[model samples]
Target: MTTETKPLALTVNGRPVGPVDVPEGLMMQDFLHEYLNLTGSRMGCGQGICHACTVIVEGEGGALREMRTCITGAHWFAGRTVVTVEGHARHDAKGEIVLSPVQQAFIEHFAFQCGYCTPGFVTGATVLIDRLKRKPVARAELEQVVTEALDKHICRCTGYVRYHTAVRDLILATPGLVSG
Candidate 1:
């Protein structure tokens, strides 16, 4: 049987990507890897449980949410704006990789070992940080709140504590995310 292809176009990492033909069954991660050469969103469990293939998608009402590319079809992201792990940082005039606050914190705290799961953790924590920015968490509730937000991401490395602490410290440092 012959595979039929359909147009797949979306904004990825602030760049407009293909309206190019892709197999209708193409997974988002595959599209990012093969079609766009953007592989920051990794391939891990492949069942969406590990969330290693998570990418941030702009959801309804302008909310930023994680979308699992391993189990999600590329077509599902058509016309939407998506942020891969590569999108989290902005480069300066000197043309260097400037890690986002979350990314930088991970390094400062030494968040990962193998780093296969770092992207997912970063994405998860980024989502939590963004959400907290809009609705500050109670200082009393901060720990539980951050834990719940990031607990779902499975890390196969020396990361949970560092990741959690990094995010917590960032939240504490940033004004308006934690209210007494």
Candidate 2:
């Protein structure tokens, strides 16, 4: 018996990745871990419900959408731009890695305990921030907005308060993310 494979091509972390051959039905989580060696997205529940394997995908109108890598097929991402947890940071003039504001806030706030669900949280929070940039949210609605945004992600070891507080504080502090 022969296994069927297809060429997979995509951009990840601002780098163009291959049209390399991949086995059919391979999940994006597996592809990231095995093929690309980018293991930041953890396989928490092997189901989409947990949101632990979420990655940010650039969508129509340049909108950011969170995708569950564990349940998403690798072929679905072909020719698309995907951002894993590793993609959030940039390098400085001295080549030192700089964390995105969300990551920095999470670390400073101790938002995560085990950090298994952190990657998904970061991706989700990023999407929210990006969305707010395009259309700022009202300050009065900020708490509910943060809650709805992160409600889907499950943090088994760590509770949700810290994550919620960190993201909320970050959104509140950022100049244009929230409006009066």
Candidate 3:
């Protein structure tokens, strides 16, 4: 048996990565973990339905969307920009880590236990927040919005209430996330 390799290139975590060779049929999660040593994206169900392998991919229009890395091919991400859980933090002038509001909320709310699904939740919530910023959701519809955004992720430890609450609190705390 022989494995063939193909060229791949993508921007990850605000850094340019690879025009290097990756094994053909390599999943994005493998590329992130094996190739780049980025281990934040966890493999849960391996099916797209679980979404525990989700990562943020920036669209050409600059919109961010959650993608299930376990099922997605590394080649599919060529020329794309991706953000993993490790990339979710903001860096200050001194280059210290500043947690994103969503990440902060998750910590404050005790949103995870084993934390296998936290990366997906964080990425999904980040996308939701970014989307809300562009088109604010009505206060009445905020719960539904949060649900829809995070519905696909599975967290075995937390019953999802904490995650949901974290997302909700982040939305409410952030200006322009919800329409008045």
Candidate 4:
């Protein structure tokens, strides 16, 4: 007799993913790093303290909410949507590629030095911008927003000032997307 395995379904980077028999206790980080080869989400702190494992779980708002893929099991992703840093420059309807505004701003501002933490920052910033769009925030609110969103990351090289500048610039560059 053959054994059947349960299937899990998730939408990743705007595409439906999986139904494969993932073993019990397979961490989301392993699924992304080993199976999917999405290496942008780094493994740091391993306990979700560093925020380097940040990845956007679809439908979350404003709070820069993310799932620590390092500790989360793949099964927990069922029926949910996830976006990684690799998806930051997704193709549009016309097949033309577009980088998320946060990514562009990061590039323009030279936000990262070692680049290890860039992915987490980008993903978090993307979520933050989305939230700010719904509820505009002021300039004074910008520091707090950036601080809270990037609180989880550990950038030993850049000191986080550049990342904060980049996010602030992104918001400032687009008044309609963010206030003050």
Q: Which candidate's lDDT is highest? A: 2
**Ranking under TM-score, best-scoring first?**
2, 1, 3, 4
Query: 143-177 in candidate 4: lDDT tens per residue?
Result: 88789878777887855888898888788887676
Question: Could you estimate the TM-score for every candidate?
Answer: 0.96, 0.97, 0.96, 0.87
Cα lDDT of all candidates, in order?
0.91, 0.95, 0.90, 0.81
Candidate 4 stretches with Cα past 4 Å from truth are 1-5, 60-64, 91-97
Worst 10 residues of 4 by lDDT: 58-67
Which predicted model would earn the best TM-score? 2
Top-down lDDT ranking: 2, 1, 3, 4
Cα-based RMSD of candidate 3? 1.1
State candidate 3's TM-score. 0.96
What count of clashes does model 2 give?
Answer: 0
Residue-wise C-alpha lDDT for candidate 3, range 1-180, written one tens digit per residue: 888999998999999998999888999999999989999999988878888889999996889988999999999999999999999888899998999988899999998888888888999999999999889999999999999889888888855999999999889988888887
Candidate 2 residue-wise lDDT, 1-180, digit = tens? 776999999999899999999989999999999999999999989978999999999999999999999999999999999999999999999999999999999999999988889999999999999999999999999999999999999999766999999999999999999998
